[model samples]
Target: MVIYVFDGSFEGFLTAIYESYYNKEKPDKIVAMDDYVENLIDRPIFIETDEIKSDKVYAGIKNKISTNALKKVYHVFLSEVMEAPTVIYHYLRLGFKIGNKVDLNLMDDWVLRMDKINQQVASEKHRMLGLLRFQLVENDLYYAPLAPDHNIIALMANHFAQRMSDQKWMIHDTKRCIAVVYDLKEWIITPIDLPAPPVGKEEYLYQQLWKEYYQSIAIKERRNPRLQKRCMPVRYWSFLTEKK
Candidate 1:
């Protein structure tokens, strides 16, 4: 089996797809450089991410397929599933063949699989929008932490940027060490290594008040742990102030 290694970036993954088509050889596996353990019996081909190649692939997808198709590809990339790259490779191959009708091919195995993965990422993005909680930290920065299963911090950037257009805030995805920071006007994604600043005393008091209000509004006689878990999964409770 032949393995193609990339830089573990979406651009690099695109470049790998471009290389496969340019070289006219499909690889058995596509892996990131860091994750590959050498296998003496398998042929390993290292692929450097080429901007020109990646751009061509990006442009080709946009030109040959509908813009919505390109969005699906991006959503699938954000899924962070182990087989995402391979799945994307197959999906793109079918896309190039059927043009914009690729998504309409629901009966095709690759299209069906890609659709499910895209839904998973989209669902998580929507959930995060409602579930995210922020606290005012030192320096007046609104800070929120998340541990989403997928790399979706970037996907939520635009929504928050518009919603909090005049505020300076940062949403950190602790699972991936990435943060989407909006400085009132624009947003950017960056690796976050800064220590969590102390919360202001006033902010702590507000949090306590919110929790108290949540408890006070609840009907103890109607409490249902299973129903609550079904509505809002227990995994997300750690980041919620009232649940904490």
Candidate 2:
């Protein structure tokens, strides 16, 4: 088995795809550098991220395939699922050959898998848009913490940025150890390691009021855990102010 290993980056993955086509030899597996181990039975090839190679591959996808196909490739990458690179490589192979028509080929296994990954990322992004609860800190920043299954902070950041353009906010993804911080103008993604800090007095008061409002609005006769779980997954309850 031939395995291609890269730096666990989207660009690096694209470079690996470029290598396979350039060498005219397809790899049995495509994995991140840290996930690879030297195996006597398997031939391993390490691929470094090349901007030029990635750019060429990206340009080809945009030119040969639809730009929407390019976006699906990126959304699937953000999914961070098992064998994502291998799946993306196969998906791209089909996309390049069939052009935009590849999207309609749901019967194709690679296309189906890529679609599922993209949908998973999209679902997480949509859920976070409503579930994210922010606390006002001393710095006048709205701080929210989440631990989503997929890497979706980038997807969620733009929506919040446009809706709350006048305010500074930080959305930290604990699962990825990354945060998107917006400074009332632009946003930056960075590594953050601080624990949840104390909220301002007014923030605390507002949270209490919100919790009370939730309690006052709920009717014991109409409570349905199953329906509630269907609308809002139980996993997200921990991040909600009223559920805390």
Candidate 3:
């Protein structure tokens, strides 16, 4: 069986799709170079990323398929799931064959899987918008740190950039060691490794007050641990001021 390997990039993945069609090869699997493991049986072919080819495939998806399908494909990539490359490949293959109605065929395994992954990425982005809590750090910068299940820092950054347009802020995805930083005008996503910056004295006092207020407003008699855990997973408590 032929196995296609590509650089761990969206462009590279799309290039792989382009190569598969041009070369007339039906690869059993399409995986990132970093994720590929040598197996004695399968033949691995490494496809170089070509912007021209990738762009053509990208435009074809947008023009031939629905724009919403193009969006779901991108969100599936951001999921970082090991099976994503192969899944996206098959999903697109079907998309090209049936046009926009590919998404309506939920009975198809690839379509269903892609839809589920897109939903997961969207859910995390939405939840993070409400749950992220920022603290004032040095230089009057607002810093919030989180470890989300998906690579959604860029998506969240756009939301905050519009809402807090006048404020300088950084949202660090500690798990990924990357951050989306906004300097009041524009925002960027970059690789970074940093210890959690200390909150300013006033910010610390505010946090304490917020935590106390959280407790005061809660009625112990109506407390439901299971429900609370479901709504706010325990994994996120470390960065939540009130939970702390």
Candidate 4:
């Protein structure tokens, strides 16, 4: 069996697809270099990322397939699932044949899997947008930390950058040790290892007030832990000021 290995980048995956088409060699699997494990029986072909090749593949996907398909493909990639590369490879192969209607073929295993992965990434992005909480820190910087299931820090950062364009903020994905930092002018994603800074006195007092308000507004007789947990999962409570 032949396995195509890439550098775990979107560009690299696209390059692999380009190679697969031109080489006319069907690979049994496509995986990121970091995720690949050597097996005695399998022949691994490491595909280097080529901007020209990847760009051609990308444009083909955009023109041959629908723009929506391109978005779904990107979202599925950000899911970081173990089988994502292989899934994307097969999904694109089918997409190219069927054109824009490939997503309609929900019966196909790869299509269904890709759709599900895309949905998962989209759900997390939506949830993080509302659930993300920012705390005022040193240099008047607003810092928020989270551990989302998907690699969606960039998506969330883009949203906040537009809404809070006047303020400086940072959203840290503790799970991945990366952060999206936004200055008043622009935003950027970068690797980070810093601890949560201490909340200032005013911020502490504000948090306490907010928590008190949260409790005050709750009707003890109508408390519904199950419903509350469903709306706001327990996993996110650690970072919420009121929950703290």
Instruction: Give per-model TM-scores.
Output: 0.94, 0.96, 0.97, 0.95
lDDT of 2 at 218: 84
Candidate ranking under lDDT, highest first, comes to 3, 4, 2, 1
Q: lDDT by residue for model 4 over 1-244, one digit each (tens)? A: 8999999989999999999998767898999998899989999999989999999999999999989999988888889898988899999999999899998998999999998999989998999899899999889999999999889998787789899999999999999999998889989889999988988898888888999999999999998999999988999999998998
What's model 3's overall lDDT?
A: 0.92
Q: What is the lDDT of candidate 2?
A: 0.90
lDDT of 4 at 10: 91
Predicted candidate 3 versus true structure: per-residue lDDT over 178-197, tens digit per residue: 99999988999999999999
Give the range of the ten consecutive residues with the poorest summed lDDT in model 2. Answer: 22-31
Mark the 10 consecutive residues where model 3 has the least summed lDDT: 19-28
Regions of candidate 2 where Cα sits further than 4 Å from its true position: none
Q: Show model 4 residue runs off by greater than 4 Å.
A: none
- The local distance difference test score of each candidate is 0.88, 0.90, 0.92, 0.92
Model 3 alpha-carbon drift over 4 Å, by segment = none
Question: Which candidate's lDDT is highest?
Answer: 3
Strongest candidate by TM-score:
3
**Between 3 and 4, whose lDDT is larger?**
3
Model 1 TM-score (2 dp): 0.94
For 25-110, candidate 2 gives per-residue lDDT tens digits of 67999998867888799988889899999999999999999999999899888888868888989998898898989999989999
